[model samples]
Target: MRYSRILEIVGDIVKVHVPATENKQTAICFGDLALIESIADSARPPHLSQVILLEGEEVSLQVFSGTKGLSTHSVVRFLGRSMEVTFSPNILGRAFSGTGRAIDGGPQLNDEPSIEIDGPTVNPARRVLASHMIRTDVPMIDVFNCLVESQKIPIFSVAGEPYNQLLAQIGTHADADIVVFGGMGLIFDDYYFFRKAFEDAGVLARTVMFVHQGSDPVVEGLLVPDMALAVAERFAVEEGKRVLVLLTDMTAYADALKEVGISMEHVPSNRGYIGDLYSQLARRYEKACDYRGAGSVTILSVTTMPGDDVTHPVPDNTGYITEGQFYLHDGVIDPFGSLSRLKQHVIGKVTREDHSQIMNTMVRFYAAAQDAQQKQAMSFELSEYDHRLLKFGELFQRDFMDINVTMPLEDALDRCWQVLAECFSRDELLMKDSLVEKYFPTPADTLSQVDP
Candidate 1:
């Protein structure tokens, strides 16, 4: 391949001057990987880069490594390929950098074949509509907002919330065959916490982590989601494994895009983000598909809202792409804002016959409890129903809404019944008489049963 000369350099971006005769199809194409080398001094190692923009004979590239001490005389060699990562079962239990290099200090993988990152999604005809649920024993998720298989959802939270803790809990207990984790702009402590948590749970053998710490390159941060989803697709398609992809702090990913976009001199959109923010987010989320006659890929990501602003470009665009979102507030998943759009597909069909009625009733009572608490704060005269609502709220939170509460779906349902029976009489529940007869405890029966 013929080499080109570097025309200019600007903070991790290099503009190479390709000859007019260079083939547009074969050379100087967008997304093509290139190796930049300083010709004046042959000792400097070659830096990897990707073509970000092309204008006639001028091609702009974003160097994974910042351009420092490099002259205009540097030679650029196009690799004729885009970014790729190794895919194999060996990746499980292993940690990799955003660039797909082994960061776990283990032996490098040699037998795995490379798959291109950010490829087109699976065909629509090949995808089956999501019909199953991915149970993560968390009460707010499993009991209320069921996590449907192959559904794309997010945990919308702000800084300082225990979103990471919640994510770790799900990773440790979710019933997926494998978990693919991608952390963007995380601190070293957060990285260590995730690794240690998975290892302690003895689930490292079934987890793959692609971590991009805050200290890593911005370009690397942008690659984490794509790399993670690509490997997940391969596992579901070839191995017939139910895969769950978890991404933390996608807002960091968007920020990386804005940083790179500014360096590339591209026009900005709302909040100074790139114009393709929505498209970029949709491309990644759309990969959550259930392949026909094969396994499935579900995405449960954390798209943190800056200052708890839902109108932020990242979360705003995400709200349109994902099926529904879990609102993590003050270390608890707020059931009011949290919803699963596809939960209806599996509620009664796959779950218990009482699942629908119980979920609605619990939420309705919780709303009433909120009003009762507000009335108490104002020193309003307390009525019998108001007093009962206050009692119901406390028990519901302690037994079910607490993030630390871990129980099976059936147990959670049973616990819900116990809470209702303790606070409200049989006639006030407003539930079906048949369901009440089967699940709700009579006064005599309630005296025999204790807190679960």
Candidate 2:
């Protein structure tokens, strides 16, 4: 049904007066789509909008294209549906705007199947235990924090860190069958970098991107995650494809929510964000699931903490919803700050026998190395073991901790054994005697492996 009276035009929100009716057919539900048409100027194109707020005889819609060209006299036609995105095999290798319109200049997907966005998450009974791992060939992730299938985790980093590059690396090398990426408030260069990275790695054929640029309408940024997750859910359930969804800079997404909330005159909560921030975020992260008899959807998102403050509302709330987080700092994944709660599920079950032993030993030595370096910095006396620890620390950061280093999990495990042998004796490892005897390098081999 069409309502001719637009009550107010504030920013991108257009409030329309729809009289209350007893009939259920014409009831305006929140999140329903609307078409805003200019009555005086028929030549102007109609703008698509979504109902964000509904009160007695008053309905407010957020226009996707902005409200600069809209007037209070514009007609609002309710579409009786929420937002949706096109879904098909052809959607792979394609890029779409936040509003689900093709922006890559490729053929339009108007004929493809359309699926509704922001639906309820999978039921707990329908989900299976996440026992499988999604290898990204990055030792810090594969070796230390094993990313399990259907896990939802975020990369917590501040601006200026190479979080996007890390995300691109994961997207290119992740073992999942499909990658669905959502970029919120990304600049042109960052967006181009992701596109080129996927194309160069030859993964573009199996990837799909839904992006909202920094200059786009703020309301559009709020839709990118929903659109990307909707497609991922369909692929995992219907096609039985293991889908990995990557969203970058969720802080920008949360900021967009704050902006919309203020525009709608809603009372702000902590840090000027909306009151339902947790609910808004959990609705998306909870979408990660491994279907009992089908495939899975694993979400890895980036949430940049403003001013490097973990207490910031965006990262703070995100920390509660996600299973664990990878703390990215100084261009490396900080071993001490990062945690993967589900790594125990796959450490020895799916990986090499020495996986658990090597992981524990390597991190233990790295911590000692950090302490030894602190002593050296203070100009205190350093013991021979401290000297060995310093050497091990340097090699650890250069070989395994470096984000650019990529290798198979087994090779990484072997490298860990080699590094430990180079720094400390067999007894120093404190690992299982059987594992050390089988995997630890011999004294002669360690000497030969050492660089001259």
Candidate 3:
């Protein structure tokens, strides 16, 4: 059905007045797509839009291409459907805009089957417990906080941090069958970096990106996550492929929501964001799931906190919805701030027997190392134990905490033993005697090994 009159033009939103039907039902529902065409100028191309708000006899649509050339004398044609994206094997190795159109300059996917985006999440009864781990070859993650399959977690950081580089590293090394990436408000340099990283690592063939550059319309950024998750859900269910979805800078997404909400004259909540901020974010994060009989979708997103404040609305709300978070700061994943609520499920079951003990002992010693360093800074006379702790701390940061250090899980565990042996005796470990005897390095063994 086509409505001829536009009531208001505010930002990218165009309000149209639609007459009630005989039954007095809504003429158009929210989320439905519409095409807005200028009535006086037929030469202008129609702008694609989505119904964002609906009131009595009035419908508001968000123009994906902005409302610059639009006027009040425009026609709104409802499509009777929500947003959708193409889904097929061909999407692999391709890049798309937030609107689901090809932006990689490759062939269009018009022939592929189009699947509706933002569908309902999987039923709780149909979900399986997340038990398997997704190895990223980063010891800080693989050893300390395992990325359990189907877990939804975020890298909490501030602006100017290496969060994007960490994300790119994970995307390149993660042991998932397919990777679906959503980049919101990314600059051209960052976008090119991700593409080049994947291409150089030879993982682009199994990767798909849906990007909304910084210059794109704000409304488009809101669609990037939905489009990426929609395709990931399809691949997990239909093809039985374990899909890893990476979304960077979700703060940009929330900001986009705030912009649209303000344009619509809605009442603001915290920090001038819409009242349903938590619900809006939960709707996306809850999409991470492990199907009962099929594959799974693990979501790893980046949420930058303003001013490094954990109390910021974006990161605060995300913390509640996600399983846990990786606190990335100073180019390293902070062991104390990072936690994986599901790591217990896989630490011992899927990994080495000493995995759990090594994790606990390493963090405990690192904590003591921090204390020792504080004492040294205070100009207090350091004890012999403190001296050993200081050495261990340096090695810990250099070997495991460094973001650039890459090693397999077993090799990382072995390196942990080597470092411990160099600092303290076997009895100092306080781990299980069985594990200590089996994996602990002896003096002769330590002497035989050369420093890398």
Candidate 4:
């Protein structure tokens, strides 16, 4: 039986108060998908599109574009389910729009199981320990602060910094078997760069992309990540593949959600965002899971601080939901403010023997050097130790901490030892005696240093 169209609205929401019969009552709820077809002025043109969403009996359909030409009595059909993403090996290397529909003009992926987007998260009790490591070839990340598999982390950067380049580089270099790239509110340049670079790197075969450009309906941005993750979860759990999910500018994603929440006239919370801000973010981040019986999803998300204010609601709420954050500043990862809470999980277990010890010693002295720099700037009388610390901090920043300092983990740690020896004696550095003897260069040993 066809349903009758009852009312219409302008903002992508169509009201369909269906007439009911004894045993043929309508069974539709909010968030179920609905197909809408509209014919305006019958002679001019007709608008047709797939199910967008169902709110009560009123099916709110995104009319591809908006309902600019839609009129009353336009036909609507309920799909009886929500929008779903196609999950299969074929989905990799393909690009889709926010609605899980292909944008690259490729053949439709109809073979994979169609699972609902934004499905229930993994059970907390069933989630396995995040023990494996995801090696990103970037030295500042892999060596200094390791990214653990199944870890949910965000890079906090300003708008002008190279966070996009960093994300693309990681996608090109990550050791994961599969990568799901989700871009929310990307401009044309950024969207094109990812496609070109991934193709050139030959990693495009194992990757999937879902993009929502700036001009697309803002609602698409909110759904892009969920669409990507829906496919990723299926790939990981079924194929036992290590998957890395990369998301750029999640702030735009959140803002898109907040915009919809505002359109619905929901009550405001902190910073004028909807009250469910934290829950919305957690729903996406919680998708980063390592299935005990199969594979995993490790999330590396980008959350840009508006006006460089970390206290902005978008990032402030993200900091709470994610495992930890990579605080990017001035085109480099700021060691002083940046931290990886799960760095300890993999430092000694998955990495080299001296990784944990070297990481501990380097950050500790780097802190001391910061204080020495402050003293010098204030014109305080500098002591011998202060002078040495000043030199150590400068060298640390120029060598290990900068993003351009790309090297393997072992080389980065050996460089750390060289930086330490130039400023302080082996005993004063206060490391494990055995580790020092094994890894640290002796007085007679020749070690390379950053030429001052």
Candidate 5:
């Protein structure tokens, strides 16, 4: 194979100067992979890199590993292909690096057909309208927000929050056929937490994880989402599986993009991020889709806000692309700020008949409780109702809103009613009479339960 000479090396980026005559015969395109051969030491294995930019005869590449001990005269062999990941059922229960290499001391993946990552999203015409709900068994989400299938939602959170823990819980409890996790810039502890959580929950057999640690190659960080989504798409499209793709700390992913953009000398947009930040995020989120007759792919990602700023570029841009977001504040999913845009389509239709009414009542009482707490703090005399609100609020946080609480939707709905009955009278709830009559506890009902 013919080779081109490297003209310059900066950090992980290598600039190869190709002749106009050679370019005509062997065209170099963006996203194409290449091998950098060491002329100085021919014994060393060829380093892998990808073409990130192309202008006339000057092509720039981002080396996967750092370009250390590399020379300008190194031979550049264009692979004429983009990066790909092996896609098959064998990928389940396996852990891979961001670049799709096995990193969990597992056996090497056998010869499986690989598919290119970062491809275009499935066409809208082929997508079935998302009308089904994927139950995560979390009251804050399943009851209030109602995670619809094929919907793309985010957990907008700040650092130090249990966002990763919440994600692991969801992966353990979500009812999808398979769970695909993509972690960017995660610490070793965070990575271990996910693996242990999945293993303990016995879901590891149906889960796949692609992790990019804080110390891994920066370029590999950019590939995690693509590798995850590519495999997820294959499972949904080919294997007919309901796949849930969970990504934690997309802010780190955006930071990696900014770093690469800066090295490439591209003009920065908001907060030093590349100009196409929204498009870049949308490309991945749009991969969530429901096939016509097969299963669907639902994306629930985490976009951590730096300094708890909602206007930060990562979450700011994410808000526009996702159907809705769960605001994880103070370790609880804030109901007032969280919403699911497509929830209405499934709330009453797919969920239980009383799901909507119960959800509304729970959130309403919680809001009232917050107001009562504020009134108490301001030294205002509390009404009898205010005291009840306070009690209800405490119970809500303890039993329903806590991220650790795991129960079926029906059980959670019953818990909501019990909290209401213990704190307030029947009339105070103002719920649908049919539901109140059906689920509300009465004096006799309470007595019968205690005696037995």
Candidate 6:
């Protein structure tokens, strides 16, 4: 409904005083659109802004770009609603900017009507427990740290790392019904790489990207997540499609949030960020859940810490919100730090019989190897056991832990056997006798592989 402009130039925020007295509501939600026109310049285009606050009849709108050039006598029209994003089958095989604008040079989409962003949360009663596994066909993820469906997790990395490559690879390989790509504050090259990679891998047919590049409006970074997730939820619930959402550089998104919060003069909680940081993170994460009888929405995001500092406000707050995180260092997934909290739910149960035993034994020996390295660095005596541990650690890191060593789960487990046998005698493994007899190599075979 159209209303008379009440007050303008209210210190960077335009206040449209209209009687919501007829329509009773608590607060005007984020992403709600408001059209403002300059009364003096009647022919001027409408200054599109979104509702920032609602106090009875007083509703404040934050201009998408800024409130510059907005005068005191501007006509304000509140749509009494938020910005709506279009989602449909046509979204597949297409790419969009952070604001839901087409960027792939594709034709316009007009089939499915759009739904507003900042969608409602899934009812607890309608949410099923997250136990199903979502495999990305990446050894670092599948064999060691399992990714469960509907789980919200982040890849903690640093700048100049291969986090984007990893995310692109997951898009190409993850076994999901649909893929939603949300790129926040991405460079133009990074954005293009995603489009090209998906198209090349043949997954673009099922992928939808919402990008907020470095050159675009900063506010779009905050909108990208909500828009992607809202569409994902609809597909999961309405069409029963398992949607995998990949968001890159969430730290950028957090910074954008902080920027807007500062603009509003909101009080800072931790590190000058808005105090509701945790809740905001949780609200988005909680959206990553499986519907009771429908499809699932799984979230895998990248959170690059400032200077690789996990204790920074963005990653620090995120650590508490996500189920677990994958730590990427030096272009490889670190086994010592990367963790999947729900791994036990799928590991050893759905994976091979040797999965649990091998995963455990590999990490255990690698730890011993780290100790051996320390001792060796300090010129300590290398005990016979220490020598063996050192060799095993080298082999483990080179074989199983190397990011370039791409192999299936069974092959990885078989390689684990090769390492275990090379380092110890049948009697030294401390494994079950029955299993040792089945897996451990004979003396003759050991001499053949382990040359003196």
Compared with the true structure, what per-residue lDDT tens digits does model 1 show for residues 202-296? 99999999999988877788889999999999999899999999999899999989988988888899989999999999999999999987899
lDDT of 1 at 205: 98
Q: How does residue 406 of candidate 4 score in lDDT?
A: 61
lDDT (CA) for every model shown?
0.90, 0.92, 0.94, 0.80, 0.89, 0.82
Q: Write the per-residue lDDT of candidate 6 for residues 386-441, one digit (tens) a residue.
A: 99999998887777665655566676676677778888776666666776677666
* TM-score, structure 5 vs. true: 0.97
TM-score comparison, 5 vs 6, better candidate: 5
Error of 2 at 92 (Å): 0.5
Model 3 weakest lDDT span, ten residues long: 20-29
lDDT at 267, model 2? 92
Evaluate residue 45 in candidate 4 and report its C-alpha lDDT on the 0 to 100 scale. 44
lDDT for each residue of candidate 5 in 263-283, tens digit (9 for 90 to 100): 888999987999999999999
Model 6: runs farther than 4 Å from truth? Answer: 1-13, 19-31, 38-45, 439-452
Model 3 lDDT per residue over 311-358, tens place: 999999999999999999999999999999999999999999999999
Question: Model 2's lDDT to the true fold?
Answer: 0.92
Candidate 4 lDDT over residue span 39-134, tens digit each:
445554443333444444444454444566666766666666766788877888999887777888798777767888868999989999888888
- TM-scores of the candidates are 0.96, 0.98, 0.98, 0.90, 0.97, 0.89
Q: Rank the candidates by TM-score, best first.
A: 3, 2, 5, 1, 4, 6
Which residue pairs clash in candidate 3? none
Q: After superposition, how far is residue 71 of candidate 1 from its true place, in Å?
A: 3.2
lDDT of 2 by residue, 276-387 (tens): 9999999999999999888899999999999999999999999999989999999999999999999999999999988988898899999999999999999999999999
Measured by lDDT, the strongest candidate is 3
